[model samples]
Target: MSTANTSNNTDSAIGAPVSATLPTLSRQDRDDSRPQQYPSPSSPHATSATSPPIPTPSPRNGRAGYQLSLPIPRLQRSEWVNLEGLVECALSSLGKDECTGISELGRGSHNSLYEIRFSDGTSCAASISNSPRQFFSADAKRSEIATMQYIHSSKLYKIPIPKIYSWDLTFDNKVGAPYILRECVKGKNLSEDGRFYRLNARDKQKVVKELAHVQAELSKPSEFTQLGYIYRQEGENGQFYVGKMATVPSGSDEEDKMRESFMGPYDSLTELWEARIERETLCAIGNWSQLPSDASLPSMLPPAKANPQQFGELQQLLSGLTNLFTPPEQLSKLCIHHSDLAIRNVLFDEKTLKITGVIDWEFASVMPLVITGRFPNDLGWEGNEFARSLGKFGNVSDGGVWNHHYYDWTSLSGVQPPPRADMPSPPASPTHSPASIDYLTTPNATANGYLFEHQASVLEDFDNSEGRAPSPPSPPLPPPPTSETSQQDLTSRATNLVELYYYRKFYASKLAARNFNLTRLFIDAVAYIKFNEIVLGGPEKWFASADWIKEVYWRMQEEDESAREDLMEGKGVVKVPEVFLAVRRREVDLGKWENKVMSMR
Candidate 1:
């Protein structure tokens, strides 16, 4: 059918709640001035020469509430849709027709959002999967829709989630794509809103507290018996069930094979970790037969070929560590968690500073609590200058006191000590009066002076027998403030630093207070180690160096001891050692280096 005729038929057939007088574009308008075409970059059917060029929205356009248009590549030809078909399906889903507007909201890594406004002033968002690879497949979409619906229907979870209106898992529908049409959450994304930073410390604390509450709720145990994605049965009121894991595509045919082989509803954490390691290993070493005819080995494998033997050894190491950390009781249950909890995924009212909704559930999955439990990324101030300044002031322990010797008050207060030579000497003793000292200075009196000096030296030699250096003079107290303005500025900065520290502390405390297990799982060092081994190629890339391995192993042992002590004491928070942080920094740098090398190929 013609696009316009299809829209008209949809409006009349559905009896949509849209005005009958809504305008329709003429044939000329439809052909010349309709929204621009966005063809998939990987599609064989590229736009013809007569078609208009693709649109490229500037960065500023995104900030101005316009979509950041970009070419979205599709993994299969069936996942293609025309604008008219998209609008028609969206209208049918909303039970509305003759919509006032259909505008692109934004495009993400795996999907694109479009805002569909109707004549009655109501609006809904349609999220269409742009890539149907291993991660954004039809199964993944089904799981995401089921998850959102389950959360929306359950009264146990007080977290604000957008209501799902309709969803399609097949590409044969009118939309010609797997999609979910849901309520258009009203409010700016928390990360994009500047009002959050300007709030008073109390209000800011409240924000983090609420976020913590939401996270705690999400980490609650589920009825599932395995680790995987949630899927609903094929009925109007179907029951949700655990299904195969949804994973990211590695942009290679080997990734497809690996996913089919390793994706599972695993019975144990060890099984899951092993499957992940195996997948990463094989995908890193791409399938030679599946490579394009013209592609070179370097283009697929990057720096060098991967050693399967090394991957096997790494898997064994991870297996041992996973067993060490995984409690037997936790293996039988799973908890659902948002894949990414950054501020960008959070919507909040600017006036009340309350979270209105949480969006982007395509990657959410049901997994072991240890894997699901994590602090919200927004509360972290890892690379902030203020956080660094606070760290220099002192390391705050779980008890909310500066316990360790990490404090450098002199540096924080910006005070410089006077030179050693300028320090005042003690007054001369009565036995060695000034006049007696003058006589000692005279050349004729050198014999007595030499004998006295030698006698004093004997005592000094006795004092130095232990080979300890003499204690240095103490620094003077800081001088009085130069101005009230400077004092106010210092106070303001100090207050900000304190707030930053406590915001994270408060979040950890909330989780710990509910159940120390949550905190334990959140900071589980074994999980980080596994991530390094599988995702970052830690075993093959860095573990070969004896010094690197030794440092990481030592840090791991220290963390293990500290974790044990904290558990015994029923403490929720464990201060990470500086050595671990240094190691993570190195890992981050290495990841960047690897990316750079890959780009060069």
Candidate 2:
């Protein structure tokens, strides 16, 4: 690869035009010019606005001039409920309770969490959903409550889950949003000591067994006609009926828009699989501009309309992989699945190696057993390595059944994992430091914590949502591909890994059609390549009609290399990294009907 020259389009951070040769400031000089680091957890600045502003390199608009500042796109500000109002709402749920203490737990794209304590020493957590989406609707919230209540009632697994004390799904109350108050699970997250790496072999083995049992219980066949989200609906006579998601998901509206009509509690696995693909495609196209931006991404050049032929090729690639996962004839068993089963959602008594609570069931649904049998993602995840592993063609293997240690839990007879005698250490002591236990448990991906929740949180939060104003759909969907076409896509010599190639091709065309900013496109492309380098073996794709893509890829790689060099010398600018998890489709009502319910109230 030839060295990249930035003389034509790129300018320095200070707005000075750059020469063909790159700047060569001393490491110390670069370090001095770099942005200030986040303050220590104990420092007042750590948790307050006193800290330095997040660096926004060249946050310029339009497609004309380009500068080489960090490419962190602006965060879209969404409507959030007042913390004081939220506190009052939680207190009201408890009926004449006196609030002794309260603190903001955390906030995600759609929900804000708060922990409340009453004078009677009773504590509970309030999860208030704001700006609900198709994936995180009132129905999804209701499903979560029903699932947790069911689990607690069934006593199926030895593990425990938080008990719901109160819930309001209609937002008919003063809170004006769906809120749930539940028992505050009192244990450290399983990842408190650095994920699985920090756990002893005994602890690891113990956790695996316990989790397997929980899996078995959830997978047990129950009274259900088809596969979909599980929710509780109260009838006119005051009887609550448990069944499929209150609203099945249809791939036709903006993810944030709630609708009454959806696909189904499919009778066949193939039908469900097709619905899943349709939902994803619709979401990507419909919510392109609503996604979030990443701080570390490099901006893209002005995107031009992609050629129909190129777009068609990309479509063929996507269809290929979609079919690979969605078998046509095989009827897979369906069962309840915790779609987002990661370490952060699992609370543990580390000393005793016992699971305290399993939280966050918004994405829970009844789906094919293969979907649930795959090992928990946290099993082998750790930073960039996890990304690299995804790209490794050799790693392309079928999912396996959960490893059973104690009993033949595969039968789903509500059996528990073997009991152990180990006693758990006391919870970490309270501290005023910003990194205290409270802040640590917030599900987020930052330098300080595990990135699983961070990944799960950012699915619809795409990086270029606003940086590039979306254009009209360029090329319409082509005829679906046949089995032979899919086979060709997988066997392509350019990349042995079929999955990575198809995703890259599909997104490239999709973004181009939407007129994604050129610089941002380059940044996203390179990051994808770097993270999945092992899978692709190397970045080589003949199907990419946008020639500028290769150039930007090389340039961004060069810039990243330079930044790393400066980082080693303690003087280079560092971009805040971002993670993307697959979008989980479950039943959620964005509020069309809820609004009607509120109106009646």
Instruction: Give the winner by TM-score.
Output: 1
Q: Best lDDT goes to which candidate?
A: 1
Off by over 4 Å in 2: 1-80, 130-136, 155-158, 170-172, 193-195, 235-262, 276-331, 382-601
Q: Using Cα atoms with residue i matched to residue i, what is each candidate's TM-score against the true structure?
A: 0.57, 0.46
What's the residue-level lDDT of 155 in candidate 2?
45
What is the C-alpha lDDT profile of model 1 across 1-601, one tens digit per residue?
0000011111101111122111321222121211211111121121111111223222221111112112112111133654455555655544453344454444433455555555444556666765543334566667777888888888778788766777665666655666676666555443422335566878877677767777777878877787778888876678988888654444456545656787788886667666655665565455443544323422212223223433454455554444334443532246776755545456566567678777656557776665554445344322122222233212211111111111112223542222233443221101211111111011011111211110111323322221111110011112222223264655554454355555666776787776655655544533333332232222323223222333334455656676755533434322334222243223334477886887799
Tell me the lDDT of model 1 at 63: 15
Give the alpha carbon lDDT tens digit for every residue of 483-594 in model 2: 2334343233113222223332333343334332221332322322221111111111112212222222233345655554553343432231232122222236586787
Candidate 2 TM-score, C-alpha based: 0.46
Whole-model alpha-carbon lDDT for candidate 2 = 0.37
> What lDDT score is found at residue 249 in candidate 1?
43
How much is the lDDT of residue 7 in candidate 2? 13
Clashing pairs in 1: none
